[model samples]
Target: MMKNNQPEVWLRGALPDIPKLLQPAAHALLQSKEEVFKYTEDFPEALLWEKPAGRASVGFHLQHITGVLDRMLTYAEEKPLSKKQFEYLRNEGVENPEVKMDDLTHAFSEKVDEALKIFKNTPEAILTEQRGVGRKQLPSSVIGLYFHAAEHSQRHIGQMLVTISVLKP
Candidate 1:
């Protein structure tokens, strides 16, 4: 249950200085961050890579949450993905025993911080500006990218939570 009986982020009124057009995106992203941390607290490192019933591992969700935000935000800025970003994307789901749960969650939290900073600076006027996605150059706007980032992160968060619940023994 939400503390103080507060409603969802969108129901809480306007976020200071956030563009009106991007408010829902910001709310969703913030909500995703809160739930990701909540569900992953005390999650065991040993189960980080476990796939329950063929579902994606917790580690994959963690990495992808951070990476997608980075990639989408890059696109939202009308920039192409860097070689480094592509490299990170390639390695997202690969098992790394050296990676701890806290490390992945911390990285995700840092990405959320970066995203919030971007949201604060984004001009409402540029929300509809066109941007290309990936090498195919699929068209999308700044708002589309940000909204997708928010929804995509929440989708992964749901999957991760289920995996965590099933793996926690």
Candidate 2:
């Protein structure tokens, strides 16, 4: 159960081993992870892919949060997406009978952990260095990519919560 009394991750003070410049991004990602689990804790698997009012399903939000983080982190490292990464992106909203809310939420949680490890190891100096995003190679910096990933995760979490509420009995 989530403890409502404690402050959000950003207010919990600086995380150890993360660079000062990257702390907010890390905090945001951590908060997103917490919110994802909290909102989906009692969500029924039967409604995981339900799209109430034609909004994106909760399952897609969960998967996209995880997959986008992976892709963004890869770009931050100045790398291209692998074949498997592209495959994941293509299937983001497609539902499978095997997928459950727990599995999707847990994947997002794990992706956040992976992101933290990258943030810890990132050199502060290179944060502002330019990097490219997507096939068009739109310009962005390391910090930009990381911050986008964090903010994007938070956005999807909010959408997922609304979808879950609409679908819940």
Candidate 3:
């Protein structure tokens, strides 16, 4: 929940231009963005990479939610992952002394904005178009990919929240 105790994004009303079927996905993504900012505001840069009990670092989740959503949206567009995308995936949880929490959070928020734009432009008729995921090209529809992106982001946010609480002292 938000620190201000505001209603969740869905209750805020339909986002302009997003298809009815895609509304839930948009809402979830927006909510994730809000929570990420809320929880990470003023968080210590030093703790960003900490992984208490072997859990993923908050930084990993921040990077991951953005990366995964970008990849999934590319799949939704029926495209293959680029070499750069694969490289990013391989480096997701690695320690990086140069990384900053603000940078990670900004990337995630920007990705969510990109997602909203995609949802707005997507014709409802095309939401069901068949798409492939990863090298295996696993079967999924456009809407399926979008939904997965939304849900996957939320799942990581929850995991990140747990790590944040545990490490916050």
Give lDDT tens digits, candidate 3, residues 6-99. 6899999998889999999999999999999989877788999999999899999999999999999999988899999999899898889888
- Candidate 2 residue lDDT tens string, 1-169: 3557779999999999999999999999999998987888777888888888888998899999999999999999889999999999999989988988778888988999999999999999999999999898999999999999999998988988889888988
Model 1, which residues run further than 4 Å from truth?
Answer: 1-5
TM-score per model over all chains: 0.93, 0.97, 0.97
Question: For model 3, what is the C-alpha lDDT against the true structure?
Answer: 0.93
lDDT of 1 by residue, 36-96 (tens): 7788877778889988888889999999989999999999887889999999999998899
Which prediction has the highest lDDT against the true structure?
A: 3
Q: Please give the lDDT score at residue 106 for candidate 1.
A: 87
Per model, state how many residue pairs clash.
Answer: 0, 0, 0
Better of 1 and 3 by lDDT: 3
lDDT of 1: 0.88
- Show model 2 residue runs off by greater than 4 Å: none
Candidate 2 residue 11 C-alpha distance from true site, Å = 0.8
